[model samples]
Target chain A: MDSSPLVLTLASIILASTPLIIAVCGEILTERSGIVNLSLDGTMLMSAMTGFVVAFETDNVWLGFLGAMGVGAFFAFIVAFGSIRLRQSQFAIGFVLTLLGDDLSAFLGQNYTRIPGPVVQHYAIPILKDIPIIGPIFFNQNVIVYFAYILVFVTWFWLFRTQPGLRLRSAGDRPEAGFARGVGINFQRYLYTIIGGGLVGVAGASYSLNIKIGWAEGLTRGFGWIALAIVIFGGWSPIRGMFGALLFGATKALATYLQRTFPEVSVVAFNAIPWVLMILVLLLVGSDFTERVITVAPKSLRRPLQRFLKISPPQALGSTFVED
Target chain B: MNANRWIRWVWPAVPIAGALVVTSLLLFFFGAAPLEAFQAMYDGAFGDQAKTLSVLAFWVPLLLAGTGLLVTFKAGLWNIGIEGQIVMGAIAASWVALRMEAPSAVLITVEILAAMLAGALWAALSAVLKTRGNVHEIFSGLALNSIAIIFTNYLISGPWQPPEGGTFRGTAPFQPGALLPLYENSRFSPLSLLLAAIAFTLVVIALRGTFWGLKLKAIGQNLRSAFLLGVSSEREMILAMMLCGALAGLGGAVRTLSWFDSLRQSISGGIGFMALLVVMLANYRMFLVPPIALFFSAVLSGSITLQLRTQLHSSLGGILTELMVLFVLLFGDWKKLGVFRKKDDDG
Candidate 1:
C-alpha cells in the first residue's frame, strides 16, 4: 500500500473528525452537569442550515458561525425551558426538540439548498506548513480547525484544572453538596448548558463553514448521533472524547477510501459503516461507562434541569440564594 | 364526583382543541383562510367514495404502525426504529412477492408472515442488546434505523433492482395472482383496512383484558418494581418490541400487496415517525390510535388534493403533521393550568 495515499487519508480523517470532537466535547460538559440533551442532532442540523444561509447572505464566514451559535443557544433555551421550567421528561423533551429543530431547519432552509456559501480559507504557518507529511495535514488548516483544537484544550483545562470547572462539576455531580456549600447549582447548570450548547452550535456551523460549504436535506445525517456516542466512548472527558472523535473520523475516512478503491462493495453498506462502528463501540464499552460518568453528572442534569417537574434541581443547582 | 369524572374527558379534549387552534394559526400564516383550508381538507379527504377510500389506504398502514408502537410503549420501551422495521418488512414481503409462484391467497399470507417475522427479528436485535448487552434501547433503536435504511438501499440498488434501468428504483412488480384484490373498482383496499381494524382490536383486547398487558403496563411504569414483583421485565420488553415490529411489518406487507404492487425506495415514507406522533397525541392509548391515525392520513391524502388544486407543495402535509404533533405536546399540559387545577393540600 502506498504511504502517500494512507497519509492523505489520515489527514482527511483528522479534518472530518474535528467537528465531532468539538461537539462531543461540548455535550460531555453538558451531560457531566446531569442533563441528557438528545436535541444535539437537531441543533447541529439547524446550525448547519443557519450557518450556510447566513454565510451566503453576509459573505462573512464569522457571521455564519455566530448565527449558528445564536440558533443553537436558542434551541438549548427551548430544551431548558421545557425540561427545567415545565418539568417535562428530559428524554421526551429532548426528543421533541430534536424533531422540532429538524422541522424548523427544513422549513427555514428549503430555499437555501445547493447555494454556495463563504468557504473558510486555510491559514498555513510558514514553518509548520513545510514539515513533510504532518505539515500540510496539521499546520495548513483554516481557523475553525485551529479553533477546534483550542476548544479541546480550553474545555479540558476548564473541566479539570479550574475552580469554576470544579464548582460546575460539583453542581452536576452532587448538587446537594454544591447547594450545601451555598452555590446556586441550577444557575450553574443553566449557564454551562447554554454555553455548551453555543459551542455545539459552533461545531455545527463548522460543518458548513469549514467542511461541506453547502447545505442539503438531512445534511448532518446522524453526525449528531455519532457525536453523542463519542461522548460516551471518550468517557465524558474532553481529551478522551476528542480521541474517540478522531478514531471515528479515521474510520469514516477509511470507509471513504475503501469505497473509492473497492468500487465493487456497495456504497450503501459503506455508508452504514460509521453507524455500525458506533453501535459496536457502544456495545463493547458496555453500560458501565454511562453509569460511571453519569454518576458524576450534575444533579440538575439528572431530571430535565430545564423542565419544571415534581423534583427540585439537585437541591442547590437552580437556587438563587435569596437572603432574608 | 361528577366534576372529577368530567376531568378525564377534559384531559384529552384540551390538547385536541389546542392543536386545532395552532393548526388554524399556521394555516393563516401560510396565507390560506383557516375555514376554507379546513373545508378543502375535508372535501379532499372524504368528499366522495373514491376520496374516502384513498384516505383509508393511507390510514391502514399508519394505524397499523401506531398500534405496533403502542405495544412497545406499554412495555416501557420506545422503539424509534419502527421505520427501519417497516422497511425491512417491506423488503421481506417484496422478496417473497417477487419470487414466489404460489396462489394469491397462500402467497399473500406467507409474505405477510415472512415480513412480520423479519421485522420482529430486526427489533429483537435491539432487545437482545438491551437485555443481554446492556445497551440502552434508545441508542439501539436509533442505530438500527440507520442500519435498516442502509440495508434497504443495498437491496434496492443491488439484489432487488428492477430490470428497467432508467426509471425503476425498486423491485419488479408482483404477479397479478399474488396481489391483494381491492373491492369493486375502488382505490381503497378493504383488506388492508380490515387487517388494521382487526390488529387494533386485538391489541386493545390484549392491553385491557390480558395478564400480559398488565405485566407490560407494570413494567413500563417502573421496571425495577416490576422486576422485584417477578414480572420478567426484560422478557416483556423483548416481547413488546417483537409485537411492535410484527404490526409494523404487517403494515409494510399490506402496502406492498394491496397498494404498490412493487417495493419502492420510500415504501415506509416517514410513516414510522408519523405513527410516533399519532401514538404520542393519543397518549399511548390503543383505542385512540385509530382515529388519530385516520385524521393524520386524511390530512396527508387531502394535501395531495391541495397540491393538485393549489400551488402548495405536497410536503405541506408533512409540515402540518409535524405541527399537529408539536401542538399536541405543547398544550398537553393544560390540565395543570389554574382553571383545571384540582384542590390539593398545597397551592
Candidate 2:
C-alpha cells in the first residue's frame, strides 16, 4: 500500500500506452477513409519483426523505422489491390492479408528470435523534463513518443482544417457528393490507407527498437486487435484515438502492477484484461457512437468498389489507378 | 436467361478445377511430379485401408467444424471463433472424462453433450454481444478467442495439471474406457466417423428442409428484407451462432475422445480458420462441405508425408493451403476481369 508505487504505476501506464497511441492514431486515419484494414495486427507484427531485424543488423534505428514502414506499405498495397482493384470483399481480403502477414512475419523472423535491437534513445526537454510528476511521464520519452503527439495535432489540423482534409472527409462521408464535385475519392482513400498503414508500421517498429528491444515469436500477441478496438473507442477521430490508446495502455500498465503486487493472481488471466475491456467498450458505446464516428468515415468503405454490389466502397480504395 | 443458368452451375466448379491446377504447380515446386503428387495425395488419403482410416480420423473433426461454419455463413454471421469454441468443448469433455468412471456408453454420451454445451455457451456470448450490445460479431468473436486461449492455458497449466511432472503442454491422458473404440485394430475410430456423418447430414437437412434454415438464409441474404417480413433477425442470428458452436464443440470432443489422449495446446490447430476456408471454397454449399474438407485433409496429410519423405518443413502444408485459398478467393471474383467480358455490340 505504498503511495510511491501507485505514482510509479501511473507513470508507467503513460509509457506503455505510447505505441498504442501511435498505432490507433494511424488506424483512425485509415478507417476514416472507409477502409477497415483488419490486417493492422499482422502489419504491425511484421513491421515489428522487420524493423527490429534491420535495426539489429544495421545498428540504425532510422533504418528500422524505414524498413517497417516499407513492409507496411507493401502489405497495404496487397489489401488495396485485392479489395479495391480485384473487387473482393474487404473483410475477407483484410482477414487473409492479416493471416498472410502474420505467417510471413513469423516465417521470416524465425532466425531473429530474441535478437537485441538497437535501443531508441530518449530525449528530454530541459525545462519540461524538470516539471515534477507530469514532466517525466510526458516530456521524457523516445523521439517516437514526441512524434506521436505531434502527429495527433497535425492529423487533427489536417483532418478538420485543410482543403485536402476536407476533401478526404467528403470522400468518407459521402463519396457520391465528392464524385459529383469532381473529387478523386478513390485516390484519397488509397492515399490515406497507405499513409495510415505506414504509420501503423512505424508503431510496430517502435515496439521492438524502442519498447522491448528484442524479437520473439507471436511478439505482438494481439496488440493489433487492441489498436483496432481503440479506433472505435476514439470514435474514429485521430485526437480522441490517442486518448483511447492511453486508456488501454493504462490498463496494461495497471495489469502489470497488479501482477507484481498480488503475486497470487495468475499473470495469464491478467493478460485477458485488454480483450475483456475491448468487448465491454464495444457494448457500452452502442451504434450511436459508431454512427457518429463513421459520419466522417469514407463513404465507400464497407461497400464493395464493384458494380455488382452497386453500393461499394469508393471507386478506388483498393484498385490500382494506372493511367492508360 | 440461359447464360445465367449455365453460369450458376459453372462458376463454383471453375474454382475447384483452378485450385487443383495451382495445387499441382505447388507440388511440383517441392520436387514431386504433379501427377505423382496427385496420385500420392489421393492414395495417401484414401489409397489403402490404414491410410483411409487415418484420413477419416482427420476428416471427422474437419467435417464437423466445416458444417458448423456452414450454418453461421448461411445466417450471414461469420463465427471465426470456432477454434476457441472447439477448445472449450474439448476442455469440457476432457473434464468429464477425467472425473467420471462411468461405462463407455454413458461416458461417450456425457462427453458429447458437455462439449456441445460448452461450445454453445461460448458462442452465445458473442451472439448476446451482437444482439443486445450492438457489437460487431467479428471483432467480438476475435476478442473472445484470445480470452478463451488464456482460459485454456490457465486450466492446463494450473488446475488440470497432470499428477506427474510431465510436460506442461497438454492435459492428462484420458482413461482407457474414456477413449472411443477404434475401428477393429486400426487407428481409425468408427464412432467419430459416425458422428461426423450424422452431423453433416443433419446440417444439410436443417439448412435445406427446415423452416428455421430458410429463415437464416433469408436473413443472411438480406436482413432488412427478412426483418420486414417479420423474421426475428436477432433470434435467428443467435440460434445460428449456437448451432455453429455446438458443431465445432462436437469436433473438439471427437478429436479429444478418439485421436489425442489429452488436450494439447493448439489442439484445434487452425482448423476453425481452415473450416472457414472450406466454407468459402464450397460457396457455403452444404453437400460440398465433406469433399472439400476431405481435400483439405488430404493436403494436410500429404504435407506430413512430404515432410517425412523429403525432409521439408511441416509448415509447408499450411503455406500451400493458404496459397490455395488465396487463389480460390481471387478466382471467385474473376467475373470482374475485362477479358472475361462479352464485347458490347454498338450499332
Candidate 3:
C-alpha cells in the first residue's frame, strides 16, 4: 500500500508524457501532410482553459475534452483556410495565431484562475496491472494516458501501412505528383491540419484535466514550442515523435526529481536542460550534418547511428501548392 | 499621381482604424463600453504632460528594437531572438552596474557597450547556428529565448538574489550612479531618449546611403546571384544579425540604465516582440518607427489603466497589437511587408 519512489516516478512519467505524446503525434500527422501548425502552444493553452472551464461547469470531463478539440479544430481550420485558400503564408498566420490565441486565452480565462475542476480519474486494466513494473507504468493510468498509448501505434500503423496514409505523405512530400494522381492536395492538407489540431486539443484537455490539473495563465507556456521541436527532432515520423515525446517527458520528470533532491541548485537551471538539449540536438542533427557524419563514420556503426539521428522536414511544408 | 502618392502615406492608417473598430467590438463583448474604453485609453496615453513623457520613455526601447528589427528585415531575416538578446543585454549591463566601478558618464557608456555586445553575441550565436549548423532562425531563436529567460531567472532569483532573502521581485537596486538621469521628478530620462534617437538615426542613414545596405538589399533579393557578385553572403548575414542584436541590446540597456534600478525576469517586457510588430507596421521605414512605437507604447500605457479601472485584463494590449498586425496583414499591401517586391508585380 506504500508509494514507492521508482513506481511513483515511472507512473508520473507516463502521465506527464501523455499530453506531449498526443501533441507530438498530432503535429507529426499535420506536418506529414505538409502543413506547419505553429499554434500548438496557444491552442493548448486556450483549449486547456476552455476544457477546464467547461468541465468545471458541466460536471463531465469528456465534454471538456470534446470542447477543447472543437476549439483546436477551429484554430486549425483558420490556419488551413488562410494558407490553402487565401494564399497567405502559413508560417506567418500560425505565428500570429500563437500570439492571438495566448491573448484570447488570458482575456477569457480571467474568471477561471486557480479554480479546481474535475480531473480524469485513474483506471487500471485489471489483468495488465498485475504484471511487472512495465504493466504498472503502462496500464495503471487514466483513460487519456491509455489513449495516448494507443495513439502512437495507431498513428504509426495508419501513416506507414495504410492507403490514405500514403496519400497524406504524398500531399506533403510532393503535392504536384499527388495532385496528378487524383489526390485533392489542398483538401487533404485542410483535413489533416484540422485532424492534427483536434488531437492537439485533446493534448490540451489532457493537461488541464489529468496531468497538470488546473487553468492558469501560461499553463502550457513552453510546452508547445517543445512539441514543435520534437516533431522536427522526430523527423516527421509518428513513432519517432512519440518516442521523442516520452524522452522529453522523462527528462522533465528527471528535472523535477533533481530540483527536489538538489535544493542548492537553482530550479531554473534544471528547467533549462531540455531547451538547451533540444537546441544542441537540433543543430547537430540537421540532415546535411548527419549526412556528412554518416559518410565519415566507421562502416558498422554508421547505419544504425544514422537511423537514430535522422530528421527531415516535410519538403513542401509552409509553401502553397501551385500548378505548373 | 499626386493623389496616388498621398494615398500611399495614408494606407497604414486604415489598419489602425480597422483595428480600433475590431477592438471596440471585443470590448463591448466583454461588458466595457467602447466609448468609455477609448476615452479612458486616450486619456491614459496623453492626458497630461507627465503621461506624454512616460509614453516617450516607454517608446525608447520599442524604437530601438524596431529599428533593429528593420535592419534584420532589410536582410530578409526574422530576428525573433531579439527578446533573448534584450534579456542578455540587461544581464550584461547589470553585470557591469554591480561589479565594476567608474565615473557616472564613463560607467553608463561601458554598461551600454557591454549590453550591446552581450546582446550581439547572443544573437550571433543564432546566426552561426543558421549559417554553419543549418538550423532555421525561428527554431533557434525560440529555443534561445527560453534558455535566456531561464538564465535571467537564475541570475535574478538565485545567485544574484537580493540579500534580503529571495523573491521574484528582482535583484538588489543598482547604485545611484547606475540609474539613468531622470527629468525633474518625471520618470522620463532625456539622455536615454537622445541615445535611442541617435542610434535609430544612424541606422536609418546607413539603410538609405551605405554600400553595405545596398549589398544587403542585393543579397536579400537573390542570395546566389548576390554571392556570385562577390557579396559575402555569410559575412553579410552575420553582420546584419549582429547589428540588429546590438540595437535590441541598446533597448535593453536603456531599460536597465534609465527606468528600472534592478533587473527582473520580465525585464524585456516583450518590447522586442512589440517592436517586431512596429517594424512591420512601419513598412521598414525608419522614419515611421518612432510614431508606431509611440502608438504601441500608448496602447500598453492605456491597457494598464484599463486594468486598474475595470475588470479587464492587461492582455488587451497584446490583443490590440495582434489585431493591428492581423488587420495590416489582411488589407495592407503585401509589398509593404517587405517580403514581396513591387518590381515583381510590374515584371
DockQ of each candidate relative to the true complex: 0.34, 0.34, 0.46
For B1-347, candidate 1 gives per-residue lDDT tens digits of 68867776676666566656766676677577777776777889999988998888878888999999888888878788888888888889988888888988899888989999988988888888888767667777788887887787777788878787523367778788777788776646787788888888898999989999999999989999999999998788889899999889888887777768888877887788789888987877677888889999998888777766654545566666665665556556654334556557223
Tens-digit lDDT track of model 1 for A232-317: 66766788788889988888777877899999888778888877888877776664444455456688675542231111222333
Provide the fnat value for model 1, as a fraction from 0 to 1: 0.39
lDDT of 1 at B119: 87
Expressed as tens digits, the lDDT of each residue in B55-118 for candidate 3 is: 8889988888888888888887878899999988988999999888888888888999999999
Please give the CA lDDT of all the candidate structures.
0.77, 0.77, 0.84
User: Which candidate has the top score in DockQ?
Assistant: 3
- Please provide, for model 3 over A1-324, each residue's C-alpha lDDT reduced to its tens digit, 9 standing for 90 to 100: 224788778788878988888999998889899899988988898899889989999989999999999999988887887677666666666777787778888888888898888999999898888777777778888899889889988999989999999899899999999999988888889999999999999999899999889898878877888899888888887788877887887887888889999988877899887877787878877737778888889999888987887666779887788644
Model 2 C-alpha lDDT versus the unseen true structure: 0.77
Minimum summed lDDT over a 10-residue window in model 2 chain A is located at A304-313
How far residue A296's Cα lies from its native spot in candidate 2, in Å, is 26
TM-scores vs. true structure, each candidate:
0.87, 0.85, 0.92
Worst 10 residues of 1 chain A by lDDT: A305-314
lDDT tens digits, residue span A1-324, model 2: 123565556656666777788788777677666666778888888999999999889989999999999888777766666665566666676666666567657656767899666878978777887777767767766688888888889888988899888777766676667777877867776787788889889989888888767787668857887888777766667777787788887777767777999899876789888888889887756644444445555677623222211222233342333221
Which prediction has more favorable DockQ, 1 or 3? 3
Regions of candidate 1 where Cα sits further than 4 Å from its true position: A1-3, A287-324, B1-39, B165-168, B185-187, B308-310, B335-347
**Backbone steric clashes in candidate 3, count:** 0
CAPRI band for model 1:
acceptable
In the range B241-292, model 2's lDDT, one tens digit per residue, is 9998998899888888887878776678778878887887676778888998
